[model samples]
Target: MEAVHEGEIVDVHALIMSFPASNTGFVVPLPSENQECFLSGLKLLFKQAGGIPLSIRIDNLTPAVKKVRGSEGEAQLTDEFMAFKNHYGFKVQVCNPRSGHEKGNVERKVGYVRYNFFSVPPVIKDFDDLTEQLYQKFLIDRKRMHYRKEAIIEDLWACEQKQLLKLPDNDYSVFKQTTIKFNKYNEFKLDQHLIHVPKAKNYSQLYCITFWNEFKVITNEGEVLLSDARPYMRKRRLIPWKDILKDWVYKPRVVGHSRYREYLPARVREYLLTPSLSLRKQRINEIITLLVQYDMKGINEQFYELISKNDEVVSNPYDVEWSQYDALQPIGGENHEGNH
Candidate 1:
């Protein structure tokens, strides 16, 4: 019981169900069902049929539309229903209350199906599987006129699909929704630590952040996962080794005489907290080489001689301290290896 514009005939094959908009015809994909699945189904229909209706006329099922605005007693809809309408680009024009006249076209269509096609309800299988099967049944076979213009419902649907509204750009990662408040740092936390987001858009909108990849900050505005860690990660921020202390902590960090100065090369220490595995291993080896050289310097001048070759990196030749260490004559000359 739907209206097709002048010169258009009702496409009789849309899935049959008691419609919401105009009790007159079936909703191509059951709109009274789950919003996500229902919209997905409708989009498929256009992909096959070729366009969305300027509007869908229905009988106004409660599940489809909530309440009417202004006409409070008359009709109003829920937020979810409103989102559905906007998403599909449809104007839901409800037919008169209980007036079968509004649905004459689809009424005949549904009855026509029962009389001409299935005497019993289609057998239950997995719902998604069933939908796919039925779609194949109608879209492919019913559309073939056996090769004249080579036209079918699929071509018609492809035409309709081109006219459909664009879907949202970014996918919502199916997050559990939560209300979060920003901290004084002007950043939000999914658990501990900070992550960046559009500062202005905070608190006003809801967020959907993933716990594991805190970098993937999401919002209802259709944002894709982006790394905003740099702005929040300050360089050489002095941290009490105790604050991050744990099994991860080591004797190298016992406050004021921070072992970090001796343990890690300056560049490596700067980025070590969030380093790649290979980089961490490489830095560890570099630190171990320094420790070995420093220990050997105590036993023999050869170690000091070998280490002095790296003076451009480890020491300032212009610094007076290197000359003082050079002046130290051996106290007992046990002379472990070679020249002192």
Candidate 2:
């Protein structure tokens, strides 16, 4: 499926689950088709159904199936997927290679969902909000009569829910943990995205724990260093500007060559590029302190307004009083107090 994500038209991974006997269907759109997304979608499905299915028939998806054996369809499941299945205690039936007919119902439901629900691409500002909206739509859809059962789909699904296995005491944690080394810029490449780790030493190895939509970088001693929303697209970079301001203050010259320099507001960038080293450091230090109480956007707006009033730089950009200008006006109205 395609969605407008953060102002860009991007492909979303749509996982469709169907209960053939009841014609009950569920769909979850994900940012990517990685293993975490695959397993997390199943977890959400189980939650929505209020119980786990006894057996799940799956296609040869890369996240679940490492390889399909002979014509009989014996398969080697990925270790993470195998662990998830064991945790849930469900049987996995892998469909034969190129055999869409085996899971024909679900394959058809995929198209059904695409046309009925996502015919028009949705604007996804928040992924969780989008998922909740889709869940509500599915509930409304279940109120209709089944295609062939002559019963309400929701009622049939209610009966099927009673036969499902009781949910586990706890949900499975879906994450992939690996060790990665940070580059000279204190950033590590994950899924082709560069994620900056604040205060991390260059060339240091850290534990990277990847979830469906986010990841965390931790030290060997289990201290969490950074957590950020993971980007699905390649060549994207995530930087925590506020957290790194202290480090950057010492290396003011590097700001000019930074990849993120272009993203800064022109006025703020120009302020940072001042020729006086002492002034640049002082202003950035003030910004770092101001960030604790106000966001960069607010600070930038205030700074821009202050600098715009005068051609020269304001010594204290953040602490200017516009009311002072009104104090300089005449005590009485201009027409009554004096001649023009």
Q: Which candidate is the best by lDDT?
A: 2
Reference-based lDDT, each prediction: 0.41, 0.74
- Candidate 1's displacement at residue 156, Å, is 6.8
Model 1 root-mean-square deviation = 24.8
Clash totals, every prediction = 28, 0
Candidate 2 residue pairs that clash: none
- Across 24-115, the per-residue lDDT of candidate 1 in tens digits comes to 12224231233333444555554444445666666665545565334446566656566656765767777666677887766765675555
What TM-score does candidate 2 reach? 0.66
Q: State the local distance difference test value for candidate 1.
A: 0.41
Q: What is the lDDT of residue 339 in candidate 2?
A: 8
